[model samples]
Target chain A: MEEIKEIMKSHTLGNPVRLGIMIYLFPRRRAPFSHIQKALDLTPGNLDSHIKVLEKHGFVRTYKVIADRPRTMVEITDYGMEETRKFLSHLKTVIDAIHF
Target chain B: MEEIKEIMKSHTLGNPVRLGIMIYLFPRRRAPFSHIQKALDLTPGNLDSHIKVLEKHGFVRTYKVIADRPRTMVEITDYGMEETRKFLSHLKTVIDAIHF
Candidate 1:
C-alpha cells in the first residue's frame, strides 16, 4: 500500500513557515528575506530560523544581493520544489482517503 | 510575531498519517487499527510505523481488545488533542497571513 518512501514526515518543509515559504516561492520562484517576512507576517527571527533549517536541508539556498545595501535572497531549489510537491501530494491523498 | 510557543513544529502530529489519525479520532475518540487502516488506505506496515512514532511521542495510546478476536485500538491523548489543535491553529494563521 505504501508506494513512496515512508519518511515524508521527516521533510523540513513540514513546518508551517516552511510550507508558507514554499507556497510563496512557488509563484515568484525567488524573493528576498524581507519580502517573505512581510508577506508571511513572520518575525525576522522566526523566519530566519525556519529558512536556516530549509537551507541546511538543501531544500532552499540563500545568497546575498549585490546592491546599494546587501539583502538576503532565498529560493527553493529544484529538489526542494520536487520534495514539497511530493509532500503536498501525500497530504492531499491522506485527506481524500478520510473524506471518502 | 511569536506570541505562542515556538516549538509548534516539534509536535509529532505534523505527519500526515498522524494528522489524519487525529482528525479521524477527534470525534470518534477511539478506533480499531483495521478501521483506520481501511479509512486512510494506508498499508498496515506504513500505518504501524507512523502510529509507533505517535505512541512514542505520547500523542497516542494503543491497546489490545479482548473480543471474539483480538484486535488493536488507538486514540489521541489529551495532550495530543491540545497540541494538534495548536498545530492547526498555527497553520491557519500562516495561510491567513499570506492571504491578507
Candidate 2:
C-alpha cells in the first residue's frame, strides 16, 4: 500500500517542471508565483497550469493574502511531503546509478 | 553514476504502454508480435511502433527465423532485465498506495 503511493509520487514527479515545483515547495513550505517562475524559468501560463493540477491533487495548498496588496502563495501539504520523500528516494536511486 | 542510469531507466519506463511491453516481455524470454498484441489487447500498429522503439534502445532483441515460414520473435536483453527490475520496483510502490 505504501509502495503504491510511492509509485504515484514518482509518476507525478516524473516531469521536469512538476518535479521542479515539488522540489522548490518542499523545502520552504510556501512560495508565490513569481518565486517559482523565477526559479524554474517557466512562463507564467505554463507554471500556473501545472500548479493548478498539483493543487487539485491535494499535493499543494494555495492562499491569497491581503496586507497592502493581494498576494498568492503556495505550500506543500502533508500528503505532498510524503509523496515528495518517496519521489526523492526514487530519484536518488536513479541518480546513484548514472555512470557517465 | 549507476544512480543516473537507474533514473534514466525509470524515466524510459514511465510510459504505461512501454511499461506494459516490458512487463509482458520480462516474464517470457521471447515472443512474436501477434502474441504480445493479443496479450496486451493493443492494436498491431501500436504494438509495432513501441516494439521498434524498444528494439532501437537495445532493451529488446528481434530475430527473424525461416523454417517453413518466416517468424519474428522478440526477447528482453540483459540491459532490459536491469531496467525492468527498477520499473517493477517503482511500480510496486505505486500499486501499494492505491486506496479504494
Highest DockQ scorer: 1
Q: Candidate 2: global Cα-lDDT?
A: 0.68
Please report how far candidate 1 places residue B51 from its true position, in Å.
1.0
What is the C-alpha local distance difference test score of candidate 1? Answer: 0.70
Candidate 1 lDDT, A43-69, residue by residue in tens: 999999989999888888999988999
lDDT of 2 by residue, B1-100 (tens): 2232233345456554665677667767688877888777778898888888888888898988787888788899999888778655543443233321
In model 2, the runs with Cα more than 4 Å from the true position are A1-9, B1-100
Which residues of candidate 1, in runs, are more than 4 Å off?
Answer: A1-17, A23-29, A33-64, A68-72, A75-100, B1-8
TM-score, candidate number 1: 0.60
TM-score winner among the candidates? 1
**Candidate 1 chain A, which ten residues in sequence have the lowest lDDT sum?**
A1-10
DockQ of each: 0.17, 0.10
